[model samples]
Each structure stands twice: as C-alpha cells, then as structure tokens.
Target chain A: MKAKVIVKLKEGVLDPQGQAIQQLLAQRGYSQIADVRVGKLVEFELENVTPIEGEAMLAEIADKLLANPIIESYRIESQ
Target chain B: MSIAVITFPGSNCDRDCLHVLQNVIGAPARFVFHKETDLGDCTGVLVPGGFSYGDYLRAGALAKISPIMPAIHRFADAGGPVLGICNGFQILCEVGLLPGALMLNRNLRFISRWVDLRVENSDTLFTRHLWQDQIVRMPIAHAEGNFTVEPETIAKIVAKQQIVFKYAGPVREDSPDGNPNGSTLSIAGIVNEAGNVMGMMPHPDRASEAILGSTDGIPIFRAFAEAAQEKSRLEYSY
Candidate 1:
C-alpha cells in the first residue's frame, strides 16, 4: 500500500513564498494567476497496512515529522 | 547549571551559544550533536541559530524531524527550559512546540541587520530580568522571519500573554517598509503556552557579549538562570 500526504498552510496564515511565486508569474506576464499557495506532497510506501492503519501512520508522520500543526494541516490518501 | 546546546548539521551558532553560556554565564554548557540520544545531565536546553540542514525544504523543516527532537520534546514536556534562537526558533515552530509560522519576508529578501525589540512580557524565565517595555538591540538574519497566524489565534495569544517581544521604534513601524523582513505585528519572539519553551527570530546569544556591539542580551540569560535557581529552591523547600 502507498499513502500520500498533502500539507498546506492553514487558512488565514500568510503564504509569502506563494505570494513571491505569484509576483514572479505576474512579472512574466502570467497575470491570470488569481491565487497561488505553496504546499508539500509527501508519499509513503507501506506493506500489509490497512487504510485506517495507513491513516494513523500518516497522522504520526504529520505530527512528528511532516507538518507543523501550529501552521500546517495535512490530508492523507491511500493508493 | 548544565545547559545542552543542540547542534544540527548546518548549525553555525552552536559554538557562540556555548561560549556565552559557558564563559559569560559560567554555566556548564555543552554542544550536543543532532544524532546524539543522550542529553546528559543538562538542566536546560538551548537550540542555537544557523541554517540547520541548509534549510533545504523549509527554514527548519528537516532539522525538526531529526532524531534528537523527540528527546527535546520529552525534556520540554517534563518542564525543562528550552530556548530556541533564530533558526532554532523556526525549528520550534516547525516542530509544533510553538504557535504560528514563519513565512518568507514580505519583501522577498534575505534580511540581516540589527533591530530594536520592546520587551512585552517579562514574567517568563526568559525575560524576567528585563523591565517591561525595555528596548534591546539584537541581530536578525533570516529569509523567512515573517510570523503569521489566524486573527482568532492572534487574539488568543494576546489574551494568554504569550507574546514576549515586538519590534521597537519606527524602523519596523510598518511590516514591509521598516524592518528588513515583514513580520506580522512586528513580532520578534514568543513563548509557548506552558511558558517553559520560547522561540524567537532574533539572536540573543549574538548580543550577549560587549565585543559583539551590544550587551542587551545578558539580561535574558540572567533571567533564565535566576528563574532556574528560584525553581530549584522552591522544589527543595518541601
């Protein structure tokens, strides 16, 4: 089994990197960019794990390694 | 007073922190490697500044997940004092030890300069030696020091008096214009809810010595030492 975790800054939190990228795109004449937010995608490969177990493992990873709960949130999906 | 300074692979300020704590403060402070599991008999832990792991993914993204952090977290949860400075601060935030997040400078530039900070709350062990509203000069060098959180969370932080330091003077009057980095509310540092852990973007260790152009950082260490002493006394009173 494989799991993918998508981490993003929580709402109302400032995304400076996203804003910088947006600015760069605008400068490059890609003005159609209405919004841009940067996030991280982490993939995990596991064997003999159920979806629930995978989710629990991903939560552990998010809390202990992948995401900083103070400002980032994560979603886990199994494949 | 034994102090442990955690040193990640790319940490450049571990020696500086060790020097200040050992020489100036006369404390037994040692540099602990990131891969080290033992914290020894240290009473307090100091996460010094510098680009840990070259700040590959994020300012402190990788360093926070190092093998030693779980031990650091256990130490902190046991009511131990932990001070995170600059890159250390970012690691704390990245590890969820502190609230809020540090984003890239609003100007999108790497900032390296000395700025004045106003002491907001001096009740913590980290700031007890300083008077309220006391101004101190410290150097900040980071590309992502701009702090941000939800408005409700900001209000909660203010209500809990978690905010410890804010930029002083007109230099950081406005987020984007004044300070080299555009920090929200011009926040320089803050303590965790438990008050035992603190994370700040400015390098207080850098300002501890007179030869470093400023000695304003002395009171912070003094306060921590005094607080530790007081706590020890209280614990033994029983």
Candidate 2:
C-alpha cells in the first residue's frame, strides 16, 4: 500500500518562497491570485497493514518525523 | 578537561571547532563521530555547523535523530554545557530541545558575512564573560536562520531572559543591514531554561581568532571552559 503526507507551514509562519512566486506571477500579469503557500508532499509505501492501521501508522510517522510540530503540520492519506 | 565536538556526516566546521577549542583556547578537545553512543569523559559538548545529512527534509532535521543525540541530551540534562552553532542550532530546535524553528531568510538567500551581535543576557554560563548589551562581531553563514516561535513562547523567552544574542542596530528603520536574516526579534542566539544548552546561528568557532577578523568569539569558549572546569571539579572532588 502507498501512503502520502502533506506537510505545510502553520498559518502564521511566513512563507517567503510562496510570496516570491506570487510576485513573479503578478509581474507576468497574473494579478488575480490573492496569495500563495508552499508545501511538500511525501509519498511512501508500507506493507502488511490494513487500511485503518495504515492511517494510524501514517499519522504516527507524520507526527514524529514527517512534520515539525513547531512550524509545520501534516495530514496523512492512504491509497 | 576535554570538550567533545560531534561531527555528523557533511559537517564542515567540526575541525574548526576542534582547532579553536583545543589550540586557540588551550583547552583539551576531541572529535566524536555522530554515530558513537558515548561522549567519553568530555565535560562540554560542541555541535558545529554544516549541511548535516545534506540538509535533507530540513536543515539539521535528519541529524537530530542521530544515535549520539540521546547521550548529548543526557549530558545537557545533567547541567553539561552544550553549545550548538549554526546548523547545530537548527538541530537543537529540530530535536525539540530548544523552542521555535529556523525558517528561510526573508529574502531567501544564503548569507555569509560578519554581523554585530548585541549580547542580550550575560548571566548564563555561555555569556558570563560578556556584559549585557555589548556588541560583538561574529560571522554568520546560513540560508535558513530566521528564528520563529509563537507569541506565547516568545513571551516566555523574554520573561525568562533566554535570549543570549540579538542583531544590533535598527532592522526596520533606515539601516536594515545589521540583521542578515529575518530572525524574530532579531534573535541570533538563545539558551534553554536551565541555561546549560545554547543554540546560536552565528559561527563563533570561525571567529575565535584575530586572524579571522574578530576575537569576540573567544569569550564564549572561555566562559564554557570555565564552567566546564567548575563542573568537573565538583564531580571529581565529591
């Protein structure tokens, strides 16, 4: 089975890379976009686990290693 | 009598740390590989800067879980002075030993330069030799040194006087050159609540000698050595 973790910076944390991308788009006449936030998607595979177990395991992984609770949050999904 | 400088893979400044601690500061020092479980009989632990684990996932993220970290934690828990410099600073935060996270610079550039750091708190073992508000020049080389913490945590940091160093001079006003990275409150360094573990973004080892353009970093090493000596004497005498 495959699992995914989407890690994103917390709401109040500043995202300079995202802001720069927003500016670059504006310069190219894409002005309608209000804001942009950048994040990461980590995909991995796990075996011998039920879907429910996979979800729980992914959550544990996300909490312990995939995401830094101080600045980033993560959501896990299984496939 | 000896300080242990842990070297993770890709750590470029470990040698420099050892050189400064052992030769320049005239204190016994040794290098301990990151994979080692023991810290030996070293009184102080120094985590030098570099792109540990290739800066994967995040700066200092992977190195935080290295095998030797638990031993370092145990040392710090026992009041051993642990100094983390640059990437080491990030690792301390990554491992949850220190508060906040080091984010990318506001301009998103890898900055390398000598900047003025105002000593914020001189009461700790790390800053005891320096007077509060004394400005010192230290070289900073990092792309992600912007320190950020929530407002509540920042309050505690301020109330406890944990801030050890801050970028001197005006940041928002006319002269914005002092703060190379957009660290919250221009924080360049901070100490833990117990004041034994310290994490700073600047590379003090790189500035330990006058040939390196500044000797301001010597006081930090000197203070640590003094405290380590005191701790050693207490442990062995009793």
Candidate 3:
C-alpha cells in the first residue's frame, strides 16, 4: 500500500512563493486566476498496515512532523 | 557553566558560535553533535544558524526529529536556557519550544545584511546585559525568517513580554514597517512562556566582534554566559 500526504499553509498564512507564481501567470495572460497557494506532498510506502491503521499513522506523522499545525494543514490519502 | 553548541550536519555557524562563546566571551563551551544523547555537563544549549538538514520539508523541519531533541526538550521543560539563532529559531519552533513558525519572507527573497534591532525585553536570559528598547545592530541571514502565529498566540506572547528583539530599521517596500522578514509586529526575537528558551533570526554570533562591524551582540552573549553560571550555581548549592 501507498499513502499520500498533502501539507499546505493555512488559509490566512501568507504564501509569498504562490503569489510570485500567480503574478507570473497573470503576466502570461492568466489574469483570471483568483488565488494561488503552495504546498508539499509526501508519499509513504506501507508494509502490512490496514487502511484504518495507515490513516492513523499518517495523521500522526503529518501532524507531528510533516505539517505544522500553527501555519499548515495536512490531508492524507491511501490506496 | 559551559554552553553546549549543538551542531547539525548542515550547520555552518557552529564554529562562529563556538568561537564567540569559548574564545571571545571567555565562557567554557564544547561541541555536541546532533547524535549526542545527553547534553553532558553544559548548563545551557546554543542552537546556531545554518541550513540544517538542507531546510528540506521546510526550514528546521527535518532537524526537529534529531535524536538530541528529546534531551533538549527535557532541559527546556526544566527551565534551562536554550538559545536558537536563525535556523536554530526554526528548529525550536518546529519542536514546539517556541511560539510561532517562520515562513518565507514577504518578498520571497533571502535577506542577509545588518539590521537594527530594538531590545524589546531586556529581562530574558538571553538579554540580561542589554537595555530595553536599546537599538542594537546585528546581521540577519535567512529567507524563511518571517515569523507568523495565530492571532490569539500573539496577544499571549505580548502580554508575557516574550518579544525580545524587534527590527528597528526604516520601512522598506520588501519589508513593511522595517522588519527585514515581515515578522508579525516586527518581531526579530522571542522567548517561550518560561522565558528560558529564546529564538532569534539575527546572527548575534556574527556581530559580537568589533572587527566584524559591530560589538552590540557581545553583551547578549555575556548575558547567556551569566545565565549559565547562575544555573550551575543553583545546581551546586542544592
């Protein structure tokens, strides 16, 4: 099994890199874009853990290390 | 009464911090590798600036899981002095030893230059010999040094006088209100609730010498040494 974790800055947190990218897009005639945000994705390889266990483990890993609760939020997907 | 300078793999300023603590400040200091289990006999811990763990995942994120972190947490829980500079600041925050998290600069550029900082609170272990609101010059070198926190946390830290240093430079387009990294309320350094653990983005170790362009950071190092001596004294007397 493989799991994916998406870590993104919270809504109110400033994302300067995203803004820079958005500006470039607008310059290239993508001006209709409303907003842009940056985030990280981490893939994990699981051994024998069931879906329930994998979800719990990934949440803990994302909460404790992968994503900072103060400024970032994380989502987990497993298959 | 020595300060333990914890060196991570990518830590570039470990030598500079050790030099300031051991040679310039004349305080006993030793190097403790990242793998060290215990902090040994050192009274205080110094987390110097550098690209620890290559700033992967985020600045200071990877280094938070280092083996030495548990020992650091124990020392901090006991109210021992822990100072984190630049990358150190990020690591401390990642470990929840500090209040806020550092994000990319507002302009998204790495800022490296001398910045004027007003000593917001002189009563912290890291600012003992400094005066409140006294402007001091120090070099700041980091991109993810912009400090951010929830709205509620800011009030709590301000009420506790946790803000130690605030950039006092003139307002610039890149750094609104003169904060080089656009930190909230222009904060450059802060202390934890216990006031024993401190984290600052500026590199005081780089500014502790006159020949290096400033001596304003010398007193700050002296304050840290003084705090270490006090900690050692308390241990021996009891």
Q: TM-score each candidate.
A: 0.86, 0.95, 0.96
Q: Which scores greater on TM-score, model 2 or model 3?
A: 3
Evaluated at residue B226, the lDDT of candidate 3 is: 82
By TM-score rank, best first, the candidates go 3, 2, 1
Candidate 1 deviant stretches above 4 angstroms: A1-3, A44-56, A77-79, B169-179, B229-238
- Cα TM-score of candidate 1: 0.86
Runs in model 3 with CA error above 4 Å?
Answer: B233-238
Question: On residues B119-182, what C-alpha lDDT tens digit does candidate 3 reach at each position?
Answer: 9999888897898889999999999988999999999999999999999996667666788887
The prediction achieving the highest DockQ against the true structure is 3
Candidate number achieving the greatest lDDT relative to the actual structure: 3
Query: Model 3: which docking level applies?
Result: high
Q: Write the per-residue lDDT of candidate 3 for residues A1-79, one digit (tens) a residue.
A: 8999999999988888899999999999999987899899899999889999999999988988999999999999888
Better by DockQ, candidate 3 or 1: 3
The local distance difference test score of each candidate is: 0.82, 0.88, 0.90
Give the fraction of true interface contacts kept by model 2: 0.57
Report lDDT (Cα) of residue B119, candidate 1: 91
